[model samples]
Target: MEKSNQLFNQEQQIIHRLLLNAPFIPSVGLLTGQVGIALAFYTYYRHTECAVYGDFAGELLDNALESLDKSIDIAFSNGLTGIGWGIEYLILKGFVDGCGVEICENIDQKIMESDPRRISDLSLEQGLEGLIHYVLIHISASIKQNVRLPFDSLYLKDLYTVVKQACQEDIPDSFRSLAEIYMDFIEKQEPIDYPLHLFSFIDIVHLDTDKLTDYPLGIKDGLAGLLLKEITNE
Candidate 1:
């Protein structure tokens, strides 16, 4: 009986080590989602140069704030459910300290500097894509460093839960739809089955298969796919 207990203890120790060392244990979505939102905001700011789009730009900014508020509320509501609201608080605190205030002030100044009466004649969709590209580039290095391992369904589920919690606050219906689609895309992209309804906050969006190459997300997808396949095959 003592020998059997010793074997069980050894097995438990090994399992613990495996969980800690598992490359996919951490969620890459957190970093990617932040980059996506930042890019969306930057796109709105850069293309609102003419009066025609000025109101639209303002609306976009309002939407962003609403999105942020909703995300925070979600985090708070779920903070007690073991999803680590402390970390969310810390991340928000960092943004507030680092770029949050500065981004708002600078964006405002930039808008004011633009010609108030004329629109840039640029396609709004085109401009948004450009901003997303910039965001992808800016966040690429950091995300690559933090989530260097393959994707795992367990980690994706955890990440999705965290994001869902962050979406609990009031947000514009438009932003809410986009957020839902984003989560759905991530879910579909995962190589394994995750409990979808268990994390029901995200609404799946129709994605352009060709647009996957347009940003850092494309690279993330490729790398994650490769890693998951490699790990599972092993």
Candidate 2:
């Protein structure tokens, strides 16, 4: 994980420019990528104790929403469920709360309003199912992260039902089956099964082992693998 200051500086400049207008526009991809990178760097620090990546990840997340002063809400240019993944990370990592939590909650509401059947693109990153996959990932994350019985025993369960119905009839029941497992884990009804179901979660998110480090965000690296990494890190 060692690197020259030049590489750090280059990454800084690139992310900085992309982040400047992030909060003001509907840049879900960009904003989510920023958060994913931060999580990767932070997780790298957590796993390997690398201060450089940790600090860089922190700074990246800290300055991510600079335009919040201009806009109160995180605007979405189109229908997307993965949009809230960044805010969820911010809260999970203790980066933002108060107004940040409010903003994050608003993002959830927007996601609920999104068309469960409308996947905007075919890329593994932004497709309807990909977004839904992430929604499942993040929803599972939220369930695991909660202190008060994990959002009252179910996080994003409603959204799961909405999108699940839109899927093909032959979709595997691992995720939703795990949904019950999730509830049980949160409710202490079947807590032992939660850990068992987690390994199966890889199927739900469609993780590609080879692409785990391909980038800082989107499907392969940030939003998916790193996200799962954080969950397992617990």
Query: What digit string (tens of lDDT, one per residue) describes model 2 on residues 33-82?
Result: 44445554565566657576567766655655442332323232112333
lDDT of each: 0.29, 0.42
Superposition-based RMSD of candidate 2 using all C-alpha atoms, in angstroms: 9.0
Scored against the true structure, residue 129 in model 2 reaches a CA lDDT of 38
Residue runs of model 2 more than 4 Å from their true location after superposition: 1-32, 47-50, 67-83, 86-103, 117-124, 127-168, 172-234
Per-residue lDDT of candidate 1, residues 1-234 (tens digit): 345534334223322332233222222122223222222223323333434323432343234343332222111111111112112222332322233222333322332232312322222122221121122222232243353322234443554554454457664454344445436646664222122121122222222334433322211232222222232344
Clash-forming residue pairs, model 1: 50-118, 50-119, 51-118, 74-165, 180-203, 181-205
> Which regions of candidate 1 fall more than 4 Å away from where they truly are?
1-34, 37-99, 120-234
What lDDT does model 1 reach?
0.29
In lDDT terms, how accurate is model 2? 0.42
Residue 103 of model 1 has an lDDT of 36
